[model samples]
Target: MNWSSAEIGVLAHAVSRAPSVHDTKPWSLEPRGDVVELFERFDVSLPRHDPTGRDRVISCGAALANLELAVRALGWDAQTALFPQPGRGDLVAQVRASGRAAVTELTSARYSAIFRRHSHREPFRLRRVPVRRLRALTGAASEPGVQARLIDPRTETAPLADLLEYAAEVLKDDRAYQRELTAWLSLPPGAAERTSLPWAGLVRRGTRVPDRITFASRLAQEGLLVVLTPDDTRRDHLHAGAAAQRIWLDAVAGGLVASVVTQPLHLPEVRAGLIEQLGLAGYPQLILRVGYPAEAVPEPVKLPVVQEEAR
Candidate 1:
């Protein structure tokens, strides 16, 4: 039942390319007989930015989605089980090949997008995303206990903008947060920049905060999908990450660009405000801002899906 070298290659490559908080790559892949276990690496810490390790767990969930998709793309029916080990808290998921299966067109497209998808943080084109495309993006995130809510630009933009601005203001003054940024900035550069770490609109010391009205105007032109879950728990965060990546890949396949926004939602006040402002029935885990790119950009370098060893 041990996976062949080719199978391990596919799984490792997909998991490595998953988008993570600050490109921390907070998960590892362990290929066992017929199954690949996804483990969260507790050593990868972002104490100031992700104080509760919520973002790190969510990042692992994103890796989980990619792993499953890779399995399907490899012509297998993937069977996924979460938290399969009772005492091993770091074992987030285990995906095994249930049977051989034909790869469907939908699965193929998503798998192809895994290498192409990267964060687009700059302003989008002024044109609005077609309503139909928005529907498809939301549908991608429609897993159990998960709901994708599109922020209504007309009615909800102003309040949401206010909350984001407040979060930015608070983080800007946080000395510890500033220190964390300084350290991250000091890290030696790596090639993963293209596949990860191109986020914009985050709070940084001395970064000018836009006025609420101006920020609201900017937000109204974008298509934002808020991924929510009924309860906030470790499992919920993991599910949210999976949903976020699914929606993101859908956007990429549809010729759109998007970036994830979880910095603001990390604040309790901003999280509470979103539920009230948007009349949401669940806790917002993250936001996917999707739209056409305002300008062309170089594609991320595609990495070979090859692994040297399996643990």
Candidate 2:
């Protein structure tokens, strides 16, 4: 079970492919003698969308899941310790690969999707995802202790849309929020070079801006609106990240594309508002926009893993 620097590099590379909100790969990897630890790297300068760093932790959790799977695929058994230390908030997870465990067929299949999946924000093909496939997605979300509610009723849809629009308007008017968004948005020509949100992923400037109403309307018109909820705790947020990654991988397996929006849900008011307006029972974690995309691409670049000195 001895792991060399080269082996660690390969595993770390695989971990970097996990998805994140706004492509903010907010994590640092530390390699011990035989373990890879993921630490949350917060960017305080950014505005309030992620005030509590829930999304950042979720992003790191997803990376941890990927790291485990990748290590297993490399014929090693990955033992994970989530939130290993109390009071020390930055350490998200520690994974150590040892012995030998063959990767399951399911893991092998999902591994390919890991590299191919990307957040697609563009319009999707006009088609409905089959009920069985939708169920599979729901199961994927539930696996990590999150609930995925698929909004199918027109009445429920209308209210959710309205709430989203209200939240969007609030964000649009907040200069600080706009400035933060602008900082992350990868402009037209240099998007690929930047590690931030790519302009290609954004709706055109003249296009109807994304609001709750607009988002729901678009989902009704071209895709499906899946509301992912959690039990409303910091640990729940971490589970939501794991669920989000699973669902995204399932979508890839089902020949579908997906995108996520947490901006609206970031505000406490918006989260409560959506719960009341939509008459939902659980806390909304993310709004997943899903449909068949025209193309799929590899995930954005991530910082190389810098192994910290052992304690």
User: Model-by-model lDDT, in order?
Assistant: 0.82, 0.68
Tens-digit lDDT string for candidate 2 (1-311): 34666667777777788987667788888888778888888653345567777777778767877787777767678888888999768888888876777768767756667777777765566676665666668777754456887766456666766666666557656777666666777667644333212112432222244545555655455344454554767677777787777778778766788877777777788788778876676778777766777665445332233343342
Candidate 2 — what's its lDDT?
0.68
> What's model 1's TM-score?
0.90
Q: Tell me the spans in candidate 1 whose CA falls farther than 4 Å from its real position.
A: 186-200, 296-311
Q: Per-residue lDDT for 160-238 in model 1, tens only?
A: 8888888887887889987887777543343223221122445566566667778888788888888999898889999
- TM-scores of all candidate predictions against the true structure: 0.90, 0.83
Each prediction's total of clashing residue pairs, residues at least 3 apart in sequence or on different chains, is 0, 2
Screening candidate 2 with a backbone cut-off below 3 angstroms (N, C-alpha, C), the clashing residue pairs are 164-212, 165-212
| Runs in model 2 lying further than 4 Å from the true structure | 43-45, 142-144, 189-216, 222-230, 296-311
**How well does candidate 2 match the true structure, expressed as C-alpha RMSD?**
5.6
